[model samples]
Target chain A: MPREITAFSNPLVKRVQALREKRHRREEGLFLAEGLRILTEARETGRVPRFLFFAAASAAHPLVRALVHAVEAAGGEAVETTPAILSKLSGKDNPQAVVGVFDQFETRLDQLDRGAASIFLVAERLRDPGNLGTILRTGDAVGAGGLILVGDCVDPFSVEAVRASMGALFTVPIVRTGWEEFLAWLRGGPGQLVGLSLQTEHDYRAVAYAAPTFLLTGNEAQGLPDDYEAACDLLVKLPMLGKADSLNAAVATAVMAYEVLARHR
Target chain B: MPREITAFSNPLVKRVQALREKRHRREEGLFLAEGLRILTEARETGRVPRFLFFAAASAAHPLVRALVHAVEAAGGEAVETTPAILSKLSGKDNPQAVVGVFDQFETRLDQLDRGAASIFLVAERLRDPGNLGTILRTGDAVGAGGLILVGDCVDPFSVEAVRASMGALFTVPIVRTGWEEFLAWLRGGPGQLVGLSLQTEHDYRAVAYAAPTFLLTGNEAQGLPDDYEAACDLLVKLPMLGKADSLNAAVATAVMAYEVLARHR
Candidate 1:
């Protein structure tokens, strides 16, 4: 039987709750993964969490039992907690059955086997966590190399972004680098820099995204900085037919990613 | 000078806030529109809001003044309120410069000129307000005739849905109906119904969407019901290359909508 830790005031409970903040997540090099599916994926990916907590309501669930056993076998702590504790950690009235506390797993652009992969989505200074997350999901759908976050993009580990990713964050390798470094790498890197912007002449579909392609997107508000356009081997735009000034950043990225990768698939 | 309704407790303000709820919106046949941009689009589309409220911070903004004049000229009320009041109405601490209260504008599928539209998206029992809103925005981006909500879908007029639409609610016509009525209308209608599901053997892109094309999608969780698949003139599925069980409903719709419409545009 897993040990019971029912108190909502438990110090461990507080620590899990604190992981919701970027600062705490950074300081601890840890983040929380909610729901059985995400935790299951985490386990299957060999990224088993250090801590596993489950609500009393889910104590008897077969999958919960299996997950708890999996955690314990992997030298992780699996503790049964009160629903109140789980709800507090999740910020939801009706929380999921299980949660996992995992170490932040990331790789740098320089660390990757660059030549092995061709397609990539480069996002610059994306502010919205949801958009970034959805883009991560889209990236996975197209089997892109990885997502390279340039400049000051929102933390992919942020709760909103992770939740929005719908488990793709676990699959997608996120590379964080500064503008100058990323730009320099792209220039020397083995791929085309296809910048998407409203100021471009070519229709997004009209462009040939022949693999070994790096599809670049920018911030939600101001879009790609003016000089950044110079770095692009090609620039393309999604048509704005109606009164809408822009497509949601995630939607635009998904459309572009699919156009680039889907046909070939 | 526009009237200064300084009191947050005012009955008018109370009613406007209540419009956030589906029951209240249904009862009053009214809904709220936030931000200067959406209101401006509403005005340009000739769908003038009945009530306009501006934060005093925007008193000097030229566009705000023009919008206020436009509202009042159309026999609508335009009032100035404090930032605190605007915040209360918007549920955002830093609310936009202006908000508008508009009458519900909707129609039935039968009322639409079916022959006029080549591309259409019919969503069945979509539960997410944000997904519904994004689909509406995508529908407008492709200039689809309208969105046909089959069965009990989320209210597109809800505050969250409208907010997510990013002003497309003004430009896109929304039609709500039950399954039977929608099916009957589709049978008599000119467009071909293309159902999207995981069960289908056909790849979504393989089939040419001969217009008038009705791209039908379903709920986030369960997807389109089995019987519904029988109704589709053609059934296709987006490639599921990764571990994700499904793509976000809105993303799927956008991918399909753009494929069917963008090439034509």
Candidate 2:
């Protein structure tokens, strides 16, 4: 039997709602992920949420039951709540039937096995949570090892980013560090640092990407700094035949990632 | 001298603010675009706004002055307004210094010159305005002739879509029509209908793409319908190396567009 909470004023409901904010998530060391599919993905990835909240209507769902079982087995609480409370937790008029609170995965550059995958993605000062999530999905699609964030970036654990990732957040490892530290780690590893730059005349397709290629993209607006570009082992530019000077940050990263994937294949 | 509008209650301000809504934009046959760079792009592309609003503080900016000159030369109204009024109009706390009202471009499949560019993009039932705008930007970056929207789709003129396009909406010709109509029009021309499908065993890169390749993608959640996939001249699937079964609709389109571009180059 699961715990029941119907009131919006319930303490657990308030705690779960707070996970929507970055500061709250960081303080609690827990993040919210909604929908059965995402929670199933988390389970498949050997992650059990600390708390599982499901609407009473979804109690009979086999997937939901499986999730409830997993939560119980893991000594986590399973709560049966009203749709109104679920809506309050998700901040959406039409909320998912299920929402889960999971501990944040702390990833480090030193822990990453560069030899595990042929490609990796690095973003510098990425500000958009949606873009960060889209990049994570692209990383998953291309089978890249993980995504690395250098400098200030929007929280990957934000609800907006987690939603945008479409569950890639669980599948892809994310690392947050400074530029100097990231460069130092790359220097220590056997990886080709390729910077996507506008200054270079070298076409993105014209180059032969070496193994363990690390594709680096810059901020949505400012792009990579001069010294950062200078440190790259190679610089490439995507063709922009139209009047628009550049593609969206996430779109550019996807294009480059696919190009690298093709070469590796 | 430009007209001065410091009152938020002004009818003109209300009218401009109404453009943010899809129904109002359709009824008025107008749309809003913000930022000096985007407005300049519109001007360069030979499309002048019917009304240009600039903050009093930004009136002296060289770009703003140039825009004012262009609007005045074209018999368009240039209004000097307060930042608060601009914010009210744009619905952004930190609104751009300038915003413009322009007539929506009426585009049709018959008007598109498919031979003008070797690549084109088609999206089916794209629900997200942001994804629609990003696709337009991708179309511009790859020099696609245009983007064709099939079935019920979000308004390209929505402020969210327009902003996300980053002025690509001005450059890329967008056609909205039913799927059957689009197929009939596409079949009448010398082009290849290549769809991004999960059903296909053909790797996206393995195919020898013909000239005038029309890259088609499905909706964000459901993907392409069976009949739509069957109708394609060539069906291609992007590699999903990780657990994610699909990429973000816009990101997938960008990846495919770049591949077609590479082959054409």
Candidate 3:
């Protein structure tokens, strides 16, 4: 039987709650993935957490019961906890039956394989967490190699973003860097650096994306920095047939990513 | 000079607040559009509301000053009110400089022109307000004729959905009906009835959409009801390459919409 934790103030609970903060996540090198399906995805993707938790009342539920034993079998701690304790740690009025805590993972710019033979996404100064997460999901759906979070992009691991990603969070690798570093990484060696912009005269469909593609998208409000646009080998635009000037950032990125990847395939 | 509304409890304020609720919107036949760009789109698209309101301080802003004249010139009312009044009516701490309340426009299925010569979308039992709105935006981007809200979809005029739509609400025609009625309408007379489903073996791109297309999409979680799936003239699926079984509903719809429309154009 897994040990039951009733006290909300337990140190382990405090540590898990602290992981919600990005600074603490970075400092402790841990982040939380909640709900049963996502935790299962984490485990299946070989990104299982160091610790797992389940509400004591739900321990008998087949999936939770099975996951608990699996966690224990894999040398990770699995605890059964009271609803209040789980609620406090998960920051929900009613917490999920299960939660998993995994270490933050990233690939350094220098670590990217030059001839890896896969598409990658670069989001320039992206802000909306939902957009970032949807972009990640699109990247995964198209079998992109990874994502490069350029400049001050929103945190992809934020709860809202993770939920938007729908388990793609575990499957796709992400790299984060400032403008200078990203440009240097691009210059060194990779794939075709293409930018999607509204100001461009070229239609998106006109561009051939057969070469290993690095599809970069602009921020919602400001778009790609001028210097970064200069660095891109091609800049393309989606047609806007109506009064609205542009589609939502995530929608535009999805169109670009799917189109580019679809052509190459 | 437009009348000033300083008291939050004023009858007009109460009425405007009531518009936020679907029941009240249905009862009063009105909905709101906020923010500068969307309001501008509303004006340009000839969707200028019966009533437009501006915060008193911004009444002097060039765009607001111009819009005030344009509204009156176009036989509409424009009111200038205090910031608190605008904030309360708009339901935001920092509300947009202006807000417009327009009629809830819904065309009856029988009223649709028999050979209108345009594409249409059918969202079957979609629940997410954001997804519904994004679908509207995509529909507008592709010059779709209208949308059919079959079964129990979210209210398209709800604030969150309207924001997601990014002003496409004004340009697109919409019709609402029960599943049986929708089926009856689909069979009566329109165009090719195409359905998108993961269950289908056919790839979406391989299907030709050169004819007037009525694309039927399913709910985010449960997807199209099995009965509706049987009703589709043809079924196709988007390619999913990674572990995630599906893409966000709006993203998937956009991919399909762009692809079909691109082929025709």
Compute each candidate's TM-score over C-alphas: 0.96, 0.98, 0.91
Q: Candidate order by lDDT, highest to lowest? A: 2, 1, 3
Full-model lDDT for every candidate: 0.85, 0.93, 0.82
lDDT (tens digit, per residue) of candidate 2 on B1-265: 8999998889999999999888899999999999999999999999889999999999889999999999999999999999998898788999999999999996899999988999999999999999999999999989999999999889999998999999999999999999999999998979999999999899998889998999999999999999999999999999999897889999999999999998998
Clashes of 1: 0
State fnat for each of the candidate structures: 0.49, 0.93, 0.64
lDDT of each residue in B165-196, candidate 1, tens digit only: 99999888889998888888888857789988
Which ten-residue region of model 3 chain B has the weakest summed lDDT? B111-120
**lDDT tens digits by residue: candidate 3, A1-265:** 5777778778888888888788888788887888888888877887767788888788888878778877888788888888887777778897988888877888888877646646888888888888888888988898877888988888877766777888888988888998888877777774788898877898999867746789898898888878788888999988877666667788888888888877887
Q: Which stretches of candidate 3 lie over 4 Å from their true place?
A: A5-29, A70-95, B6-11, B70-93
Candidate 3 lDDT, B67-108, residue by residue in tens? 777788878788888778788878889899998888777789
- DockQ, candidate 2, vs. native dimer: 0.89
Chain A TM-score, each candidate: 0.95, 0.98, 0.91
**Model 3 alpha-carbon miss at residue A125, Å:** 1.5
All candidates in order of DockQ, best leading? 2, 3, 1
Tens digit per residue, CA lDDT, model 2, A127-165: 999999999999998998989999999999899899899
Arrange candidates by TM-score, highest first: which order? 2, 1, 3
Give stretches of model 1 more than 4 Å off.
B262-265
